[model samples]
Target: MNCLRSILAAGLASLVLFPAPVRAQKTGEAPGVQGSKNIRSMKEIRDEGVVKQRWDVSCGAAALSTLLTYDFKDDTPETSIVVWLLHRVDAKRVRSRGGFSLLDLKHFSEARGYHAEAFSGMSIEDLALEKTSVIVPIREKGFDHFVVVKGFVAGHVILGDPGFGNVTMRVDRFQTLWKDGIVFVVHPPDDRMIGEKRLPVAARLVPDESLISRKIGVTAPSNYLY
Candidate 1:
């Protein structure tokens, strides 16, 4: 009965995360054409030793820790960070059911050098968070899960899934999984951590270069593979 209840709880979480499938956007262009230009790929950063969640129901904390350590390197154990985040969220069910309330997440992230928000829809520019990570809710393995989106490539959003190390999915397919379009985005701080530097590569801005009136610059993650 305990096992059954756990399974049922997870099932409910899945429905809440991805309520329904969304129709794919009809774009006449090829997938390659839809890929963003001049953005750092998640592969690059994941290779640089991002922290993984150490607990089963600590996906929310793990994803947040990854973003917190993305620009700044901290030797703190991920478990410790998870506890800190849970306290900030101030929810009792998070430890057992494994999720953060949108209000709690927004308040916690915003207080810690991030501009966090809950959004139903966003533009490509919005997804293009240079130094930040977007927490996306998805359904998998009969449960709802959180994945941190670190970068974009070939029209696909690269995710640092708490359950799966790293994965990529078509934007259209991603939207289907992101049912209800609820997303928590963490924007980077104005002053990046020490040793963070932008690459010299000039990227063609998405939505066209005319909007920005200048070529956008991208950064290359440090190449220290773990």
Candidate 2:
């Protein structure tokens, strides 16, 4: 559906072309603790009343995905996420209110929100973007995002209108070859587009941060509101 594609596009457009347009209440750049960006691996991010769950990424049933999962690791029990729009969005046909959907993956709080399709303002092809950042509750006290580099070996899902058919839930990580300091979860290594850029993406990382905490069931028609 275009909703997923649009959401996906706004997410990985490009830092240079699409800087933070407007501050999406639920997403923003994370500030370092005491003014420090140096965070060690497996360090404390956030905890919400439990012990470590899994051992390794391979051990967990969850497969490697580029739809980077963010485990909330904030000092306060309450975590927040600030999602900045990376591109102009205006597919108001069938999205939630105001083209913003920010919800807590863990508990079903009254705050569960959505953005309308027409609210985004710009089409998927347009380069309008917003920088969204959110702080949440993870055993670790920082933002643990799951990034996957996607590779299309044999098939593809194209976006509609602005594009068509799309990989609704395939891309796991993002690899930015055109420039540096760009971050987005790309598709698998087999994707044909990866070759176009021919960038070297990291093969493996530590374990699954999502597994470290309780797997909060998240399903919303990929990107459409029920």
Candidate 3:
């Protein structure tokens, strides 16, 4: 009995001396220790512009809306943008849920006078000191989701994840999940013109989710002077 008691006491002492490390939360503000003190976030998106992808898998649209509104100062509804993009891709309906592909995003942005380029061969080192934000599709739970890569913090990459707000993860892990290392960097026109075109009649339809659920119906599609 005394030997057993001694073993139990030692085990308890060891536990007290060497507690297990606390794992970081998977969402929201990153743990202070893991990220750098100098952090940069798109304040407009966090404010009135953050596009939430409620029911429709319009993460691409939401991400694009975020960039347009925050970076380009165009506050267009996300659902309308989704519809517009679907028409551009000839997808027919917003219910397709992420029906818009990365290629589609590039074409649509270019049509609107934005400079969008796709990068398949890029390393985290390549993103170092890159001031512009990028959109990358990450595969999570057997599906690909779109997210805006804000910048690098410490060794982790800061992401404007539509589903979870801001999140930070190590570059290796991000690269592992990022589909094909595919990244689309949307750059505003050199002339500083935002969405230099009017929204087509087809893009005017409100996505079912937006109108019925959010009750935020738009009168007409946004007119970005393309």
Candidate 4:
């Protein structure tokens, strides 16, 4: 009996000294709060395509940079745009007058071989049909700012804001802030050759002078904004 008690005690002591290993969480199992947080972070990163503005008055440049980089894949830095615009216009004047204008952005786009147009009195519904992204100026909290309107997603207007990384707004709220309904649309040079036959190297090298005379028309909007 004493020998039996000694064996039982040794077994209990071994158990106390060495507990069984715990099972690790499986890869297929739900990650709970951490997984949800990771998903939200990914969504934010996917939505933000625009480069954030470095200065307060650089939103216009930043917006244009976003379009060039994100839409056309130009990858032009925002500072390059600011420097280019400031070279043409007085830097102090720009700062005092509240930054660059739509006309300035239009000229910049043209210089980059892109056709740009500004239309007033356009509605959100009209914007919904645009094939490419557009830059819009809005008044919020008594301040004028520029943002790249990516498009509608699930009933919210997705914007690639220069000041803010990415933002979403309701249709009604966006309309109120949009006020004059001004929109600036930029068309890449390649868009003009959608269905056309390939041109000879010499012909392609020559700029399309006819583009200057091309009439601007609105077409059906597409689901993809950029």
Instruction: Give the winner by TM-score.
Output: 4
Query: What are the TM-scores, per candidate, against the unseen true structure?
Result: 0.54, 0.18, 0.58, 0.66
Output candidate 4 Cα RMSD. Answer: 23.5
Higher-TM-score candidate of 3 and 4: 4
Candidate 2, residues 1-226: lDDT per residue as tens digits? 1111112233232212212122123334466634334432221211111122121111000111111221112121111211112122333411322122222221112222222121222222221121221111111122122212222221211101011111112112211111122222112223332223211121122122122222222122223111
lDDT of 1 by residue, 1-226 (tens): 0000011222322222212232244546676677334445423432343456555555666666666666345344557655666666544555444454455455656666667666765655666744556666655333566666766655666666554344445677676665355567666565445344221121111111011121111211111011
Error of 3 at 216 (Å): 26
Best by lDDT: 4
For 89-193, candidate 4 gives per-residue lDDT tens digits of: 887667555677777778788998888888888998888888767888776444566778877754557766665455556678788878488888988899743
* Sort by lDDT, top down from the best: 4, 3, 1, 2
Considering only N, C-alpha and C atoms within 3 Å, which residue pairs clash in candidate 1? 35-155
Q: List per-prediction Cα lDDT, in the order shown.
A: 0.48, 0.19, 0.52, 0.60
As for lDDT, the candidate ahead, 2 or 3, is 3
Query: What C-alpha RMSD separates each model from the true structure?
Result: 16.5, 19.3, 17.8, 23.5
Off by over 4 Å in 4: 1-47, 192-226
The candidate with the higher lDDT, 3 or 4, is 4
The clash count for each model shown is 1, 100, 7, 1
Error of 4 at 53 (Å): 0.2
Error of 4 at 131 (Å): 0.5
